[model samples]
Target: MIQNQHLFHIPVMGTGHSIDTPIRIAHLGINSVVSVVDDMLCEKIRQHYSSVHNIAYQNIPKSAADGRAERITAYLNLMADIVGQKFDELKKMSLLEGTEKDRYFRLLPESNPLRKSYDKIASLTNQAVRQNLIKEITGKMTLGSIDVNIMAKVDALKMGDDGQPLSSEYSDASSALRGYANSKLSSSLVLSAGFNPRLYSYLSEFKDFYRDKTGDIKKKIILKVSDFRSALIQGKFLAKKGLEVAEFRIESGLNCGGHAFASDGYLLPVLLNEFREKRNQLKETFQPMIQSFYESQGWEYPELSEEETTPKITVQGGIGNNGEMRRLLEEYGMDATGWGSPFLLVPEATCVDELTSKVLANAAEKDLYLSNVSPLGVPFNNVRGTGSEKYTRELVEKGKPGSKCPKGFLVSNTEFTEEPICTASAEYQLLKINSIQESDISDEEKENQKNRVMDKTCLCTNLGTGSMIRLGIMKPSYGRQAICPGPNIAWFNREYSLDEMVDHIYGRRESLVPKERPHMFAKELTMYVDYINELAILADPEDAEWKKLLRMKKNLDAGMELCMEIAKGSSYEGENLHSLQSTVEEQKLRLAEIFNLVPSEA
Candidate 1:
């Protein structure tokens, strides 16, 4: 019912207020991760944040070239551990100089042929970026026999800066709002990382570098292989991989939820429903390497035996997805529609409507919508930003706001609306809704095709600020019948919890909706049950829903004496009332015998 008791709730960020703390999903951009030398909140997130989830057109930690070989391998492993402790404190005070002097300071050689000529210029810049030549100016600038033992030991000593060097890129905005509050977020952030460029042009321009644009940004590139030196250089070579590209990004307009992110709701119709369900067992089992990136940069090649580009599809417009917004409104046929944050009213927000699926389904607990807007915390504090912004206003300055504000309205989410009842800790709520209506919002002037489909989702302004009080008692309890269909959603959207949908909103089960169609009353099921009981939160919400149903019936009746001390560890994944099963084992038949294969034992 209240979206099946909002799956145990937990989108934290505290400070008083818990009038039964509902939901208010905020954390949009915050000056693109806080700072790259505070270009003044990146000029107000590039002048009042326009959205494609705009992080002022992101490319986090910027300067690419694999961020110059990850800042020259972390500036030569901290200048080879501070020049092996200033060459063992300048040769234990004897101060060794000019070659032939050897025998003196031995602390320097952890096999340093100038660190193998900077690992042969980061392996020839990953072989000229796997050959698409990501602007490769030069190739092997020397590592031949390790530069004769690095110009005879850096011509006998002299490099400084022990704290290392290339220390620049910084931006944290509370670790990008705690990675958008771990989860329960929908107000924005899709990011996905990049740098694949056709496996960086098939291992450095060796041959098929997007084979004469037949590559299509090499399958909309998303080869994200985080660390361990880019997973031992590109996740052990794109690890077997599959699906080369289907990058769909649609929007031909309308998002903040009036719908229209089409191309079958993103993943480009699951990559054309998995290339028409694996076009004939993929050349007898797996070597596909697909490609397709056409912002209409001339669209020609389609012979496609199965590769030249059938599997290749880049089409990026911007998305939520609808076969990438009906394939760019049937390739430029266009109605344009958009309305970000339902033209702003904020309190549990909602409005969404690909045209059906009961959006905001009658926003029940009273159509939530709260962010009157405030967290003005981050703006500069970047110190390389990790552990998700552990709060470093130079290490924890608390109530930030050192500057910026004398120009316009800088405080809103209702001037810190308080109602704090306490039982608190990680308090935060930011509502959403209103995706586009009033006939897909048009203050027209002729730039037709619904003004290029309402210039794809009317660039952002999303709002949020929460401490709960059901977003101030459901923002005027559904009055103004006002727009708000879907903005900043968070009922744990993996499309309402992948199919199980908690046994279809708990009638014990039965609500995927088409059982020969009967469930009446619509307006998208009363705006999705008034945006889930106005984001009603109650997983022990300070008891009283009958003492929280007698403490969930005495904590599920000693839930197995709290699951028999869960193997003595007591809680987290264990203690399920003493039945224990999960040490954690979904499936990994040694993952095909760790790839050597042939291990299907079941």
Candidate 2:
């Protein structure tokens, strides 16, 4: 019952990982989600593709903006100009007579023998006109249907060169939402983010809100949820606002790439089951609230058919092969599966450097680990021996602590001075390192803390550098690149063409992914166990760390129980069931040992 033809989407990888990704995917008649974190890159891509394809250009609101409204406005204006020029070109082409029209069409193809002559003539004749037209509309028009990410809270806010607060535009979640709304882009824009009530309130202020002309709200916004509880809370909140969510993007807490938001122990299968079983129950719970809201607003509630109202449930994270893809869609009734990290291996799909791509392909389990690398303070998934890490360590050895703070996208804290700064800024690191040295912790602990601080590279800049470097657009002084791939990426041992990857997804052909890779459920459980064990080693017995450990233990127990239930059922068979049972038992023993170490309550 998946309404959309696209059975898969490429999640926003990073600033540069998937730059211009939509263009490549759209060329192949596939819809792909590309990141708009870098505005210039987005504008360039839009300009290039506006004439060729009408693909949805998605943006991630990961790092905060300095002048979000102006930036977005400028972006829309540029797109309008490009789209306008495309229309003009089409009109001109249409006016061509029989032979001329045929010649033009023939020359349009790259394989045409006289394409060079046609390009020369067109460039000479229309270059000035196109440039003037673009200049005229570059700051005036508005565009529709761009996607934006609203990551619940600001991880880092960009600062002005003068060190004064940039416009209130970049201040908080509300400002970001308002910036998009005021630009008249809200109507067509898809607001995506984790569930946040404050953000919901801001979005509700829009005249159209989530409604379409047909009375049913359009499926434009995406909610990133790990479990049903979160989805229910978000759904009810939207219903109360007379708004409707189009999709619930279920991501695996620990099994995904980039920032790993480890769930309390809810596995992907368990969460998907809840959504499938209670999908309509959830809609029923929200329908009344939605009707009440519409009534209060003196508006008639648009009664939606079941087809329009049923929320699309899609899952991402650690999904590798055609088997897993088919199971998630057919067995679990998922609308689409997101293939993220694997897309990094397809040069046609992502902007990874040759060296970085090879490193990712050759990576093993040990190379990938959750580390305190992001300045956002999230548990980011990082690979070892990247240029970023090596450069960071070299800087630490040379008495420097942090990155150059080039692009201040991740700069939100002002802990070290009156001006807000990034935790990964050199100034902040020097001050923090000094303070940590004076703390009461052991020398070893202090050293470990310092290493953690230094480990944070300027991900904002480093992540974007891969594409620029690969395209020969910019060369960095560091001469190294950083890559963030989920542990699932380790199982993909070779580069893949986009067709091969797509084939793999639809069971046409299997490539890149290894046959012996463990089931995603087992991998996630093992990762959680490892994460808890690491926390235990660093956690003081009397601190809140103990409580965190307790929560993790509870989640692991829940996950184990769920796995056991699945093993006993008909969902899995043979090797899959054996792997599930064995992994659960192994994790259970490890959990028991950790639980025994916990001090009894008084």
Candidate 3:
């Protein structure tokens, strides 16, 4: 396992929010992931940083040969260079009070060795001894990794000017992978969403993914999975190709930001319990497969200890406070936890313009919801008063309800056009609306169908506009910024400095969330119940959808039972363990009513 100095890492936010996070915070020894979904956004940010640092700049035009991959490579290399320089400068500074070096040690967990050492050496009377110890500690300081993320399924096939589809290697995800593989970064590549066999196969081409003589993988693999079964399946597939999964980062489906990949009624606690109990099975099942592949290729399989070969299991999503974080790390045996949505409120961490930041800060629980805004048709965690929401709604009110489709990253629809166009595009919506109007269905049904068709917002461009607007790359008038923050953002009602946010994470100061906030486990459970209830209402009685809903109900019942046991176990102050018990009862009664009203499949 790669040794992370921090107990928690920031997962990738929208394509641009965390794009430059490494440059902002990696010198402080905090690991963060950058999204490589939009190469155009990357190129712009790279140009901005290059000019700021007075580095030589060159543009990779869209029509250039292998431009997507080249652009991503250039941006990542620039990021690596910038982060290294910043870290070197940070290490050279004296440990003066309130200095950057002081902030670095102060942000660390109280139990961390460096923090403890700094604490002990602060009161030393002998200047010579103190300076010696400080030098030794500074020499041991490591730079936080600048990891990159690729949504595995966001691989839209590109088209040449001649209108012919590009080769499979030129797809969105493939080019992004190649870009990362070619970069100088020695960090992990987090593959979120789901498995794409073609993308996984492409990993075999990159030698960095394999082990070297020192038994170290230069480029590691971290699969952001929702459950244990997914980990086993994808892990084994990669293992057969001699690619080891370094970590399985579990995230909540409905409770997370960005595109929600809702699981089949599998709650976070139940999922973590499975991984904790079956963690050994992962290594046991993959080691032989990897060894066999290595032997077949005449490669030396390094004789490493079991600890090095075993994959790290981590969890993220809706983790609000230290108590919940402790339960995830200690009780569930998670190696680390992820803190995403709350960082949207931390200006020192993520990129949020003044207008959008205020919206996220003042957003009530009712304002943050699971929305149908993604053109990909995935449920997205969205805030109420985003500029994108207002713009899209205004367009509808004016009888013109669709974007012009400038960027086609999420284009998957080929219904009306010979080539695929984004459903959020004006062309597609108009085509779809006309068909609905001419159909024989009732006016009410037509309106409902039209509403669903127009629900898709242009996420490919809008999601990244916040960063552009904040960085002065574009005017706020032209930037209809869309931000996806989880429901947990409701409790954090103000902007925070980087130190304040890190303090909240380490429990070094007062809690940032309110007392009325629900526990993470209970919050996820309630979401699953509400989700199934919605499906139950829409599902036809005799269809296969109803059967699926029945199975989800059974799974929720079992999950509630586990929640009850957890509530009875150990209670942390302000964690609201009692609320977990009450939520189980309340949601269970609601679930019973929904199912009772809908008949079971006969």
Number of the top lDDT candidate:
3
Q: Which digits, one per residue and each the tens of the lDDT, describe model 1 over residues 1-602?
A: 00111111111111111111121111100000011112122222222222312323322243342332232223222222332343334323321233311211121122333223333443454654533331221121110000000000001111124533222221122112222222221121111222333323333222222234333331122221111122223322332332332212222111123222211111222232343344334333323222123222343433345443322122221122222223323433222212122112222222111111122332332233321112232111011111112221222133321222221112222322342111101111111111222235464523232222211110011111111112332232222111223322222122343113222322234333322221111111222222223223322345355343333223222332322233244222111212222211111222222223354531
Can you write out model 2's per-residue Cα lDDT over 238-304, one digit (the tens) per residue? 8888777777888989888888887776777778888889888777887788778878978876667
* Deviation in Å, model 3, residue 283 alpha carbon: 0.7
What is the C-alpha lDDT profile of model 3 across 441-472, one tens digit per residue? Answer: 99999999999888889888898999999899
TM-score of 3: 0.97
Off by over 4 Å in 2: 1-3, 27-29, 40-67, 73-147, 155-195, 216-219, 476-480, 568-577, 597-602
Task: Check candidate 2 and list the clashing pairs.
Answer: none
Please give the distance, in angstroms, between residue 210's alpha carbon in candidate 3 and its true position after superposition.
1.0
Native RMSD of candidate 3 (Å)? 1.9
lDDT of each: 0.23, 0.67, 0.90
